[model samples]
Target: MNPRTMHSIFLKKKRTMVAIAMLSVGSISAQTFSDFSYKGNDKIYTNNPLKENEFYSPILQGCYPDPSITRKGDDYYLVNSSFSMFPGVPIFTSKDLVNWKQVGHVLDRPSQLKVEKGGVSQGIYAPDIKYNKYNDTFYMITTQIAGGIGNMVVKTKDPAKGWSEVQKLNFDGIDPAIFFDDNGKAYIVHNDAPPKGTEQYNGHRVIKIWDYDLEKDQVVAGSDKIIVNGGVDLSQKPIWIEGPHIYKKAGKYFLMCAEGGTGGNHSEVIFMSDSAKGPFVPATNNPILTQRYFPKDRRDKVDWAGHADLVETPDGKYYGVFLAIRPNEKGRVNHGRETFILPVDWSGKYPVFENGLVPMKPKLKLPEGVKNKTGKDGFFPNGNFTYIDKLTDKNLDFRWIAMRGPRENFITSAKNGVKVNPMETNIKALAPVSALFHRLQHEDFETSVSLDYKPKSEKELAGITCYQSERFNYVFGITKKDKDFYIVLERTEKGESKLIASEKITLSKAIKLQVIGERDEHQFNYSLDGKNFKNLGGPVSGDILSTDVAGGFTGSLIGLYSTSSNDIKP
Candidate 1:
């Protein structure tokens, strides 16, 4: 063949290869898996046996920020920023860091806080937990910013039951961390906004360590000594430093903290000092874990990763538990600030990043001697009678949280399952008092609630809702139209509620509706006998259920709701 003919054939082959590559990219992009899914029925507990030199960690779910963990004997306890969400300061326990169970809340009573309209983002900030061997007490310091209150401490021998009345710590700052040295002395470290007139709560701040009086519940000595001042550095502009946890190991004090904003640029920085109060030295290799170091390939970009705490295992292994966000197709992260565990190694006198500079994805290894029994209740367990009993526990699962702050008389125990009374408030105002909900725990899980509703008036609405917020919500309930039974599906976006789907239906003395939420999709089905079902196909679309769009301090919740112009009495 001539040279011209060969050139033409080469061009054709190049064009064909380019087309195939583009098709492959399109196919890969078209198919993506949901972040949270049912990972089969594997019983992996926190304390299960581990092979030698094996790494184990937890699948950090929800918004767990400013994580403070303490190891008491072989057991570990962890707490995060509850913000305004009630049952504040969720306390989790695990024999190992891998598997954690919701033990209880540090604050259960209303007197602990008066957060009515702060929504979910204003109640509690990062809290530090410590065990006082001298008094044999567990001390926790939480910051309540909505009330402009200083830090408050709660003590108890047992954390699972309840805590004492909050002992007010008269200190001004946000993320409060408590450090107990081996010398029987305690110090409190926190980030304070620049005096009063300087600026608002911007980044330019410092970690101040003060001699704290546990008995007096106040800072006894030491001025606000600027320990590590990253906020002053001009290079890292808009320096928002917070979430400081102090750990003393091998005669060197490590101040591990979250720097930059809690959003995409969030990071975990480590500093070292010879004493509790320091001219702390920045770790030669700072920002031990961050997205800047952990690059995302073609899969997903896990951003806003920081706010970490270091925990040592029973067998002397160091692990860091921190929060990170996984973005969706729209570049939004619904599973906000999830907790993750990565191993850390000691190099020379300081800690070094494992697996080069990139964040190490170590193989998870369960601890020795534990049991995990997840998903033994069979698929679609809403109809299972035993599963219904588990939902009524006063210790509400981490899967559940109130849309607004929870009211005292909102939810009560009924003979059947749970009873939610209507509050005398519209869904638009502060403390709607009408909604109770749980997190959309699984992507493809089915949730159904049985409630016998007798609408007192045309305004009263009671039913089950998948609520992200007031503006973005889907409600399925019985509307009082000519006293006729009808199931209605309402969708709200940008504070506007539109009736998406409604159908007339016959109901017996009782009514039940089950919502099957698929991968980024939802379906509402009604059943009178709880056996046979009718599919109500009125699909709703909004970002409220998607964590990336509805920006709040908490996750999506599914629960019973009742709204009324007058007070609802059961």
Candidate 2:
């Protein structure tokens, strides 16, 4: 909802379309409308009320955090951490940096990403994608934590055609980032333990650099050097010194990192050095960006702002892509960490965030000729337009992700839709489960999928699910008992499953399950006639699936799924 303009209302009821002016914070007058449609209050908004020179924050939404951006010519490419989701490292391209469209995933093939026994939030961590102009190659270096493959690099001349094989790196750390210097030298910077055998504080960490050899596609031996120890301002004891990126600007090397962990105190710090390998010095005003300085307020409380990457526009102006959280409730961030873009201020020695660490600015200025774009919340009609996963489609949608890496034969052709072959492990297990899901783009959206499945025994269950992790999820599935099919709504939290509601019906046909998710609450619905849906249970509080409530680094996913007691082949 842009704060400047008021668009027309498309109402199902003729007399109820009345325009009302609402005064919001930031001294902005917004014209809001309550759009009524069929099925009572369908709670849908038509489109964003766009205003000139006014853009929305959070350029990328819904769990797309730890962003790494690169500019090639007039085109901008962005990628984010996919955590445990298979087909990881979602890639997006933009012409004006305002309107972005997901182009592909870095880990698109089964061989490229294998998350068989990976934990819920353990596969990939903070991937850094860089384009080498001299060699005409794009490189992606990341840490496969749960996969136990450590830091690895993958490259491609044409990103759309997939990347080269994994080049295993011997770096002993997470959040590995590759920096290519102007002198045709490449360096790898990462967060690692503080000098092995030295006792340190809980969050004490160090940033190390290594000469990367692109010719051999490996790291140069005996070139490791500690760049920054104990973060910027070592006396302050800044914890969780991670997410490092090195950039050369105005003949000075700038090292950026996230400090104070990734939660409430998360912040972006800057260090400058004469050489990439030399000792880095902290800026006078260290922690170039942070949200912790803001006074706690009831109206607006945004937290967890850090993990940033910088990209210079064609005009020589710089912009930054960072991660932040929008908590629906106090201490409850349900939407997960999101990526935001803000202008970079370089009047001083070190670059700073133009807007500081403010979560969502009402309006932001864009580059010349670029249109302002905004993100909306509600039951948007075409919000899922890019997702093309159909019942009869042989290939899954690019937006659809599997639990960890998906097996080639997991989903096969069925009568009218795809049949999901359930793995032996359930959702409670630490290993990857048999589930395919799409990102929960909006917290206040309804997702429902109809499946033609009648379980043969209690071992087989299949329906829709709102999953946060292996140990935290809500499922509306149908479990069979001999001749009867039991439609059950279950909740799993911390490896414990509790049935919320259940209904028994004769084994007749497939069941249609639905889950309505709102900012405050959630509800489960089921339909047998395909025209009418009945409430399956009472409203479940939405906080259960939140990152604040269910501690993790990833967001929730809502999609169709199937599972069995034993390995069920499609």
List the candidates' TM-scores in order. Answer: 0.80, 0.86
Collision count of model 2: 0
Per-residue lDDT over 230-289 for candidate 2, one digit per residue giving the tens place of the 0 to 100 score:
888678777889999999988899899999999889999998899999789988887778
C-alpha lDDT values of all predictions: 0.62, 0.72
Backbone clashes under 3 angstroms, per model: 10, 0
What value of lDDT does candidate 1 attain over all alpha carbons? 0.62
User: Which one is best on TM-score?
Assistant: 2
Model 2 residue 134 CA deviation (Å) reads 1.3
Off by over 4 Å in 2: 1-49, 298-300, 372-389, 413-415, 506-510, 566-570
Give per-residue CA lDDT, model 1, range 434-487, as digits (tens): 565555533345666666666635566677777665556677776656666567
Which regions of candidate 1 are displaced past 4 Å? 1-60, 195-202, 231-234, 293-297, 352-363, 368-408, 432-434, 528-537, 566-570
Q: Any idea what lDDT model 2 has?
A: 0.72
